[model samples]
Structures are given as structure tokens and as C-alpha cells.
Target: MHDFPDIDYTQRFIFDESDVRGELVALERSYAEVLAKHPYPEPVAQLLGEMLAAAALLVGTLKFDGLLVLQARSLGPVSLLMVECSSEREIRGIARYDESLITPDATLQELMPDGDLTMTIDPRQGKRYQGIVGLDGVDLSACLSSYFVMSEQLPTRFWIKADGKRARGLLLQQLPAARLTDPEEREASWQHVNTLVDTLTAEELLSLNNETVLHRLFHEDAVRMFDIQPLVFRCSCSRERSANALVSLGLEDAQQLVIEHNGTVEIDCQFCNQRYLFDATDVAQLFAGGGVDTPSDTRH
Candidate 1:
């Protein structure tokens, strides 16, 4: 990084006179906190950082009160990489990889040369929407940008970078126009802003502050900057939520699982590695009372 202090935050900005809006996210504490839960290899860790950054950037663009999940699965060395960002700005992520297949310096395409990039937006008040795209790009940023271009038909670009220490990204999109809008002028603005942001280097993206990066790229324009939003590494899983999930498995199925497991049902969160356990009493109360009435938490 640079000589500046480390930061874990996301900032949104838009050109005051144009239809181009963008967001910049720099994650240090949150990224390292998630990695602290698991000892992922270098390549895997970097990929997870990218996903976490992507999740943070995407979460702010929607108007939902739920969760956004970014999952990449492949038959290659790295089988899974997942990140969850709640509408509240809490983030968590993890990766599953084969140590033998991963090199000390492996690129994303090498580790996950072929996979599906899955983006899920679940609203608390409406039906969940999921979009899937083939991982045809050489990097994670390119793949996500491709997803929006084909799936959402939005002119978008992503500049994501991560070392072992930090994860950061910048996103730019052409906003939807209103009636009587000029298509040619809108397209010109998109191209102009993208061309300028394309000049950002990874060092500047990850090291400098959000304002500095913005001014460096868009100093000539009247860019309106919004208040910075803080992002923390938080896990939203709880015994009650897990129990509700078990209840969905049905009374008979849940009890059967408890019996096979020798007396209690256990659900482990892969993101935080915390285990939420429920005993016979808990299970009975969960079904009989319609919830996880037993609040016993065996965090592992």
C-alpha cells in the first residue's frame, strides 16, 4: 500500500452534470477479518477479496432490504468462493480450494478457469432474483462486468484489485435516462468517464483514499461525492435462523437428523465457521412453539 492509513469503506459518487454514476470500495479490516476465519491460500484469498469488494459495490446499487450473495463454483482447483453482503452493509466470505492444485501465484482463470458467476439478490419483501453468466473473462472484474452487460443491459465497467493485504474496486455505470434524454450525449458521457477511470492503477486504487482516487480520475468534472459508508465484517447467522431452516426441513426430517447425529442437530456456518447446535429440547420447542425457543448457543 501507500503511506496513508488503511481504510475499510465504500464511497459513492456521480457526475453532477452527466448520467454516469460510480462507486469505489476499499476493504482492509473486513477483508482480513473474513480471511482470519480460514487459512486460504494466496490465490484463493485474493479471489475472495475480489468477491467481497464486488459484493459491497453491488449491494449499494440496489433498493432492497435483504441479502446479496456472490458465488463462484467450478470443477477446477478452487471449487467454491462465496461472499454475502446484507443490505445493512455487513459482509462475510469464504473459499474452498485444493491446496495441491493451487500454486503460490495463480491467477483467477488458472484456479477457476471455468465456472459460473452467480449473483443473487434476495429482497425481504419480494421474490428473489438470480442471474447467472458464464465465466468467460480472464479476471473476476471482467466476468462481473460482462454479466451486467449481457444480463442487465447496462453499460458498466469494474476495476478490481487485491494483494494479500487489501482489496479494492471501482465501478462505473451509465444511469437510465428519463424522457427527452439525448442518447448520443449520454453515450458520450459514458465513454468519457470510462476512459478516464480506465487510467487508474491498482496501487492508486488500493492505497489512496476514495476522494483522492475520484479527483485523480474526475478532477476536471463536477463530480458529486456522497458521504462515505462504513463496511464491517459481520456474520448474520443465528440459531433462530438456522432453526427456522431446520423447521423447513419438516418436523419428521429435522428429528430424523437429530437422531442420526446422536441427540442434537448442528448447523455450521461456513462463512464464520461458527457452529449453531440445537438439542432435543430446542428442536421440540422450535416446532411446538414455531421457533428456536431454546436460546442455547454452542459457538465453535
Candidate 2:
């Protein structure tokens, strides 16, 4: 195995003579940081890790300039699992679940039954796009694969795995009218690549580096690996954004909240546990269009 940096990153690669392109994502610190935010059950943590990895892999295949959000809402034990990845490779995620309802060995389908996965692309310069699919598949990867096939009309496959500590994913997508033009040739190439990828095991996917994984799967093929783009666990919540949220609630309601909370209304970011406080004076200044002093204890 080649020596590769064991860090959170997504690497893009393409088959030299085929119309298939791929992305490999491995998450360690980012995954750990997300898990640390809340005391999630093992099944929920593992599923959240896989969703985080899936978000990173999907973001690499897009040409957008903003945020990509992967959210799953269900009526099962886990109510919500949300993961966000920006164009800059900054990532953060959170999960909401009923601890008593979640069993130790529950599967994704059992935990998130009657759910839907929503993918939203909020671009900075253009209109936002969103696609939703029923979580009818057995896992996240299968649902997302069906999403691509139904919404994008593209042949896409995902192999994602996550333990409590680490998460990794591989995505293979067939580009349109690229190197392989003939329909039969395209189908054959797609099947060929996916067949090789099917052999990847969960342990190998979670433990191996990007290069070694690619080589092990596509050693006989011509694959061009690109530079790895680093990923980090970053919460986009800030004092200003939190203030803006407070301002959105009219002055009367904001002041009432302050009174209700004993002169301070606090906004706690669920993703990172960062607290933003607005006192009576701060709320008045915010309504008066005056700047408020930044808080010193913003870290988790």
C-alpha cells in the first residue's frame, strides 16, 4: 500500500478510457468531532458518519459554489440526521434520536423507517436546487443511488461504510457522452467498473487510503487520481448569523423572549453546541441597528 495522508479529504479521479468518474472520501477527525457534539447511540453515530462521508463524496461531483445539505427525516427512532458540506470542504452534522427507542443492533431501515432523504444545493450566486427521494432502500447508499438514477438519469453507485471512529465512501458516476459514446459500450463500461467496486469490503473501505483502495479495485485499468482536497468539521453558525435570526423575530417578540428567559435569550446551535446570548440591552441594540460586542466564550 502506498503511503497517503490519513486525513479527512475527498479525491477525484477518472478512468482514462472510460466515461466513468469517481470520488473517494475518508473522514476521521471530522467524523470524531461530529460524534463528540452529542451522545448519540452507536447505530445513530455510525449512520451519521456514513451520511457525512456521502455528503463529502457527492459535493465533489458538483460544480456549485455554496452549501450541499444531506438531510434525512423519519418517523422512526431517529427523527433527523443532517449533514452539511460546503464548497470549501467544511463539514458538520448532527443527529436527533430517541435513545430509548433505538436498539443496539437496529438497521438503517428499522431506525429510519418511513423517511425521506432530501438533497439541497444552495448556491451563492444562483437559484437553489433540491431533490427528494423516499428512504425505501435498505441503506443510505442505496437510496442515493436510486436518487441519481431517478433525478439525474445517470448511472451512479455508492459504497459507504462507517464504524464508530472512522467513515469512508466511494462514488462512481458515468458521465454523459464522454469517452465511450456507444450505448452498449457505455453500459458495458459502467457494469465493468461497478463489478470491480462490488468486491470492496467494509473493513477495506474504512481502513485503506484512497490510492491503495483505487489500486486494489482498478489495478488493471487506467485510473487518473487527482489531488486530495482537505475536509474539516466547521460549524457555520456565528454571532452575526445568530443575531440576524434574533432580529428576524420582531423586536416585541424578541424582548418578550428576553423577559421570559430572565433578561437573556439564548440561542444554542444544535450542530456545535455554541451558545449565543442576547440580553435586554443587546436585544435593544440589535433592534436599534447598533453593533453588539462579541462574546468571549463561544467555543464548545
Candidate 3:
């Protein structure tokens, strides 16, 4: 396959000696594509980036053929931040915030006062699962760490960073030990790995590639990493889906909208800024289970 520079890939690693695992995710194109759809402020953009990166990392550890959604909502200026990553690594995200109240330097708690972070896994065949935690920590990393510790009782640490252009994240978790026995041994191993990870700087993470970053941090250990998994920006919204949404509004409303808009009903995809157009006839065919198309779907 093609090799992309400093963007759209995840690397998972495990130390041979310790019962610990780690993941590194760098999102460049996907993050930029999401931002291109909406002009989010610096602070809101950062929050969205963190959620995007975190969603990718969380998906790495699970085995499900569905979508994983990470959402944060509160009664503050930044009301909602949501990111969705599918099993195929197709990702999309959006944020709703009061841009007028955003300051130059806004913290997560400030942006989402009384907020709750919710992670939902919607499987293709099985039942969906959701876990939620309050926004008690100072930042996204801390809050997520707390969630894992309290909810799953796993020792997990995260270091995430984002600017206007890139979002990068590192995750280290203590797994069930195979070699190390006793609580003290496991604790020591966790500390050893964490100490190495602690030295990583935000600049290096956002700039360097996966191999360089892993080596720079864990060169002394017996760390083994699998091949890179690529990520891309993709929206699940479609004309059929939009048509069904319109159909949900009942046949009368759908026809009314078409009449009000000059015999056309237009819907926009928030993730990708794609528009789907449906006229009166298309709506009739749509409810009849016939196929539909968007402006972009047609051949030039």
C-alpha cells in the first residue's frame, strides 16, 4: 500500500518483558478534513482533535464490527463534541460550541462545565454498549484515565496533543502480567514503561513518524510493534440514509418540504459537507426501497 507522511496511521506495541501495551496515533488528513467542514475556534478545535485521537486509540483495543463514538456534552459554551470511528478505520467528527464565548486559552473544564464523556460502541450484529464518566479531570487525557481506572480498573495513561493542523496521541496500559508476578512487580514494570514515555515531547509526537517515536521512547526495552494500520476520513451519511430520515418525518412533511423548496429537498452531511438532493419523485421511490443518489454520486 501507499505510505503517508506523519498522518492517518496507528501503531500498537508490546514490551517483551512487561505486561504493558501501548498505542500511538497521529491524525493529519482526517483531522484537517473534519476542520475544513466547520470553522471551529482554536479551543474548540483542540477539544475535537483530542476526541478524534482518543476515539482511534479506543477502537484499537476493541474487536467489533461497528462504530465507536466518543462524545462530550455539557451546559457550557462548548455544548457538544463527538467523534465516530468505524471498525474499518473510517472516521468523522463534529463539535457544537458557542464561538462568541470561547477565549484564547480555554481548558476542557471551562469549555465543558458539568460535562460528561460518553463512549458508545454500536456493533453491527450485537447489542450496543456505552460507558460514561463525569468531567472531573483537568483535561481529556486525565479524564479518560480516570474513566478506565474506575470503570474497568485498568491502569491506563494517555498523552494527547493537538494544534490547528494535527492531532497526536500516545496510550500506555497495564495488561495482565504473564511474566511479572505480584503487585509490586507489575507496578514496577508499569513505572519503568511510563518513565520512558514521560520523556516524549509534544513537538516530537506531532512531527515524528511512528517508528522514530517508539524507538525514542522504548529503545531500551524489548518492545515489539505490529505493522501500521491506516486511517481515513469517511462519512456514513448518504442519500438513502438522508431519504430515510426525510421519510421518517412522514410522507406529508417530506412532500411539503419538496414543495416549499421548489420541488426539491436538500440535506447536508455535517462530517464531509456533502449535499444530497431529493425531489418529489425521488422521495416516492425512496420510500419504495428504490435506490437514490446525491449530486456527488452521479457521473460527470
Candidate 4:
């Protein structure tokens, strides 16, 4: 149980005789990488980290081929907050918030008073699908659980918490195929597990090891934990991709952008805060050639 690398691990477990399924994730570097890009306010950073962790937990439990995006669109100064996780386990996120709205006890409703919480699943070869609902819960975990109830039509629950250094979450879902029959024993077991899990404070979940936490919650039950998977922090942005975006905007606009910005069209990655600059010569070569090459950045 302790031989795996400590990046992030999501494990599927069962109670041996019950139809209930569960997942647990402990994120270390993945959570910190998302927060390292910008100096977000304390609450905003924690909320974003929790979303990222919850996304990983969700994706790990479900079977999807493409990317899954958990997004909230609001009308407040904090207009949008998004967390995207690909089927391959790559994750990235960004949060927008109003500096004036910053408060010690700000909540999800305050940040996004009139927004919709949505989960969009885009498969690589099939039509994209989306499930939309209002922001009914106070936090991301509850909001996402609401989505699970509607879209998945399953009895699901999520517990997520995070800080600047790390993020962690647990997901419990009833398998659809196994839900046809009502087993009182299984339901009672789930309730018992839930009660013990409920006792897990945010501090304990954040500080304790995964095995210890699982044992603390389900020590009485015959739970079977599976293999661990590594969850690493990664960014998808590249200079070539940025240049391609510029090209797609049309050479006229690219040139105009360079001129307006004094000889360079600079694009910054919101996830990493890395800047990609294309100058006159860069633009000329991009148009002269059908494809653009990735630019080299001198800034460390």
C-alpha cells in the first residue's frame, strides 16, 4: 500500500458483499502546480484546488474517452472558474475573481451568485455531451454531486478539501447495474461507512496518509483497495500551439496585433503564466511558411 510514488493516487474499493463503490484521491504536486501559477487569494486558491482534486476523483471513477470539464459561469466579478481533466489524467485549471469581492468568509454563492454549474464531456471521436444545472450547492464538491445525481442518476457523494500545498477528495458511487435490487445490509454498510467518513475532518484528510485514512473510515468492513495510479502536474500549452492560434486568427489580425503591441503579439498561458511572443520576423516567417515553428523563450 505504501510503495507507490506520492504524486496523486485514485483507488477503487469495494465492500466485498456490497454493491457500493468508492474512490479516494490524494494529490500533492498536481494541486500545488495549479496554484503556483498565480498568487490567488486564500479562499480562491483553496476553492480552485478543491475543484481540481474533485475533477481528478470524478474522472478516475468514470469511464470516458476524452476530456471532462467542470465549469461555473457567473455574472459577478468572478465570472468563471474551470477545471479540466483529460481521460489520460492530465489536469489544469484557472480561476477568475474580483479583487474587491475578496473577503475572509466569502462563499461560492458570493463568488458566483447567479451561475450554472456544468459538466461537459467531449470524446475524441464522438459528439460532445454536456449536463447543465444551477449552482445548488455551497461548494464545488456538493455542486458536482448534484450533477452526479442528475446526469448519472446514482447515489453519489463527494468529500473534497484543499490548501496551497495539497488537495484531496473521496468519491462514493452506487454502481448502476448493481442498484437494481435493494439490499438493506448493503445500504446499512454504506451508511455506516458514511458516518465514519463523515468524522474525517478536513485537517485529518489533508494531513494523514491514504492508507491510514481508509483504515480509519472502513476498518470494520472488508474493503478491498486496488492499485495506485500516478497523478502528475502538466500543462498542454506550447509555443507551436500558440503560434497556430495566432495563425488561425488570420495574418491580418496577427499583424495588427503585433503592430498594436509594438512589434510583438504576446500571448500568456493562464495556467502557467508563461508568455509567448511573436515579433515581425516571426510573423513574416509564419505567413511565408504554411506552418509556424515554436518560438524559443529566453526568460527563465
Instruction: Name the top lDDT candidate.
Output: 2
Clashing pairs in 4: none
* Candidate 2 lDDT (Cα, 0 to 1): 0.91
Please write out the lDDT profile of model 1 over residues 1-300, one tens digit for every residue.
465344577889988888778988888899989989999888898889999999999987887999999999999899999999999899999898899999988887789877888999988889999999887798999999999889866677889998867999999978888521788887777889989988888888878887788888988998998888888999988777788898899888888898999987779888887888887777888889856554656432
lDDT per residue for candidate 2 within 1-300, as digits (tens), equals 435576789999999999999999989899999999998899999999999999999999999999999999999999999999999999999999999999998899999999999999999999999999999998889999999988966788999999989898999999888788999998998999999999999988987787789899999999999999999999999888888998999999999999999977889999999888888878888888886664434522
Q: Which runs in model 3 stand beyond 4 Å of their true positions?
A: 1-7, 293-300
Instruction: Give the candidate order by descending lDDT.
Output: 2, 3, 1, 4
- Give the CA lDDT, 0 to 100, for residue 103 in model 2: 92
TM-scores of all predicted structures: 0.90, 0.96, 0.92, 0.89
Backbone clash count for every predicted candidate, in the order shown: 0, 0, 0, 0
Question: What is candidate 3's TM-score against the reference?
Answer: 0.92
Q: Over the stretch 152-199, how does candidate 4's per-residue lDDT look in tens digits?
A: 677888999987777888888766445336677657766777777789
Single out the weakest 10-residue window by summed lDDT for candidate 1.
291-300
**Pairs of colliding residues, candidate 3:** none
Clash pairs, model 1 backbone? none
